[model samples]
Target: MSAPLIVGSVAYTPNVVTIWEGIRDYFAGSPAEMDFVLFSNYGRQVDALLQGTIDLAWNTNLAWVRTVAQTKGACRALAMRDTDTVFRTMFVARAGSGLGGLEDLTGRRLALGSRDSAQAAILPVHFLTRAGLTPGEVDFLRIDSDVGKHGDTGRSELDALRAVLDDRADAAAIGINTWEAIGRDELMPGALELFWESPVYSHCNFTALPALSEERATPWVEHLLGMDWDNPAHRPILEMEGLRRWVVPRLEGYASLFEAVREQQIGSRW
Candidate 1:
């Protein structure tokens, strides 16, 4: 068989399985011309993208920034989900815990989502630094779920939520959609409260090395944007990802996130 499209991303199990299979199904109608592969983390996924083991990838904001920096913008953002826009990361605490803001986190144990998470870790650290709180000043524990997906893996956020529920942490960092997903699951809705929210930024988008020609890339992205959210075939996937539709790709929407990752470089050791 010809080479598969070699999609790379984390497997978010029941909630995010739609991300992989849904995109595959969308491309399946193209005369069976493409196929995909999934990865558990974004670091390795990006490595594969650079090494040519994969043709394209669904990259997190941080990974896209790294990809652009590494490739000098030789890669391209193909498409993204509509819900990926206006996304925020939230700081949460147990109800009645009396925590007012990040300042209160001083000397307290805080649960961060993932080491590679943009929302839960990167941006949070950047904002924290802006507020004059440096890393290692507080007790920071990481709930590492989707390493390569860069905390788009809701599993890490879920772990932080549970830590707050069980009284293990004074507060936790989580993506807003992940927090909402927990509410849908009836997980401690009233027991937890949002203490702080990061400014809006974009999330996931398709990143590919510049080898794929525009002729092939155009239809691949067009098919994704053209997916009908109301159609039965696409509805289940849309619900699973907490979105109504996908959108045309844009990197400018994520410039703030890229800048955050660049300025903070919290996990440069990685």
Candidate 2:
């Protein structure tokens, strides 16, 4: 029997262990069985994937961009969550700021998350620049509370919001997931209001180097895509992982991030 393929993922949350364990069990007795190893951060996970210690990596979009930069187009994305395809950045302000759009952000203090956060940091700047807002017009408050995880912890985004709430900033940029997680609009009522949001972009994916053969990779991806949302056994894991289904990687969704990373000159390591 072939040795089980090893997958790498960052332990961003406590429930990550449960999610991967359930996935491994689902692949049991399959044509391409698998296992996983958790890392302290995405940098370590990406290193494992590059060093041939892991056949696949569950990578954040920032990690994916770095991998492509490091590998020079030698790597390929196998699959991504359905939610990832439509991921977006949210710009919010305390209620009654009268900030309706990016154009209103000029001369305002804007809080951003970790420097490495594509959703909360990099992409927000890109969107602003595209809107013709220059750095001189905006006062930026950067919160690098969770730097190494690339804002996977969501702590940074939360901190950015805190800056806005505490009157340290007039506005904040955060990921849609963080916005939903906080339930700010409903729970906080008039505490905060979203004024601007970026176009949909990709968030995370299963990345693999060319060293992993298609014969081995294909079956694993097929089995992964087989996970049904309606299945009783798969539903909990799906819910915990925040996805309704796995789909082929939407390479187009990553285009904006790639451009942002390039324009920002974000490097692979923190």
Candidate 3:
């Protein structure tokens, strides 16, 4: 049998290596083999998937939405990390900045993650609009180290937090999980506080081209869902991906978020 080509972004190479190694080991024990190609941006990754250069891609929800919007449902979701199913974006402030809530952010400087970060930038904008706020209403400072990986590299999130510490912004938008992870790092403590959280939304998933065969998809899905969390074999990768399990992909979970984004665009147009 031929090898499966996996496509993904390059910003998170450490985590990517973990995932690729795990997949390689899983498939090595099976009848088929797999390989991967890392791209620097989602546009290239999505384009490759569409042009059939890669059989499957682990894509962010934003990338998947772009794909579906462009292709009109020509792609299919295969599986996803359990952690990716529900994630929230958090608005944070310095521990004693006196910025009590979303309403207090008016005219205040705010640091946001990367421009392309759905969790830290896009969805936060949606939530802000719902809170009766607009991006221009505040001094928007951008922390843009990991642009294409969409905050998955943690660079943008960390920079946002540092901005809060340095008083660059009265508040910042960051991934909720990344905030918690850094807060527990023992090296960083009590420097920032969480003020608000965006409604949970889906994040990452595996996508397949319309022409992908079921025979190829089945083993990939099976191995993913069957990963033994309790066993030593899959522990490192699971920890790297921040998941204890994997689940079948579901596109419907993103409907509310998509609606919110679309509605926000409409409001912007007027």
Candidate 4:
């Protein structure tokens, strides 16, 4: 019998356990049996993937960028969630803060989530810089909550939002997911409003080294793509993971981040 395919993921929330368990159960009857290991952070998971301790990793954009850089573009992205393809960073402020746009952020206190978070921190700064608002142009109030987890926890984004609400900062940079979540859950209803939205970028994906053969990888990818979102058996896992369908990775969507990391001089080596 073939060994089970080992996958690594960060334990960002309790639901991670449920998600992976369901995936394992789903693959039990498939040709490619699967198992998972959870890490406290993405850095460690990325390391395991590079070190060949795990065959695949559920990597965030930052992790994926690092892997590509560290491997000199030799790594492969197998698939990503449908929701992961259209992610955007949002700049929000108190409903009546009078912030018109990115230009208005100049000389004002702007809060950001964990430094490593592509959506909440990295891309926000990147977008602001692209809009002519350099780091020195804004008074930054950075919240580094759940840093190593690469903003997967969303704790820092929430803190940044609270900072804006409490008058601690004039605005906050957060992921579109958090923005929608706040509306869906009615968390602090109407206290915040979107000041700006970033261009769309990709988020998370299944990354693997070149050494993982197509023989093993193809079956796994096929099984993931075969998941039926409408089926009751798969719906719960799909909802928990925040995607209705698995799609092939869009390499172009990652160009901004690749340039941002170089421009910002963020360390690629985990």
**lDDT top scorer:** 2
Residue 269 alpha-carbon offset, candidate 2, angstroms = 3.9
lDDT, candidate 1, 1-40, per-residue tens: 3444667775646545656677687777573245666666
lDDT, candidates in the order shown? 0.76, 0.93, 0.76, 0.92
Per-residue lDDT, model 3, residue 194, is 72
The best candidate in terms of TM-score: 2
Clashing pairs in 2: none
User: TM-score for every candidate vs. truth?
Assistant: 0.85, 0.98, 0.89, 0.97
Per the 3 Å backbone cut-off, how many clashing residue pairs does candidate 1 have?
3
Model 4: ten consecutive residues of lowest lDDT:
181-190
Candidate RMSDs in Å, in order, are 3.1, 0.9, 3.4, 1.3
lDDT tens digits, residue span 1-270, model 3: 666646454547656776777767776756446777888778788888888888887888778777776678788898887878778888888776777777788899888888778787777777777789866887778888887776778788888878888877788888867877775334555677777777677888888877888887887788678887898988887887778999987677677557655765522110
Q: By summed lDDT, which 10 consecutive residues of candidate 2 come out lowest? A: 261-270
By the lDDT metric, which is better: model 2 or model 3?
Answer: 2
Collision count for each candidate, in order: 3, 0, 0, 0
For model 3, the superposed segments whose C-alpha errors exceed 4 Å read: 2-11, 184-190, 260-270
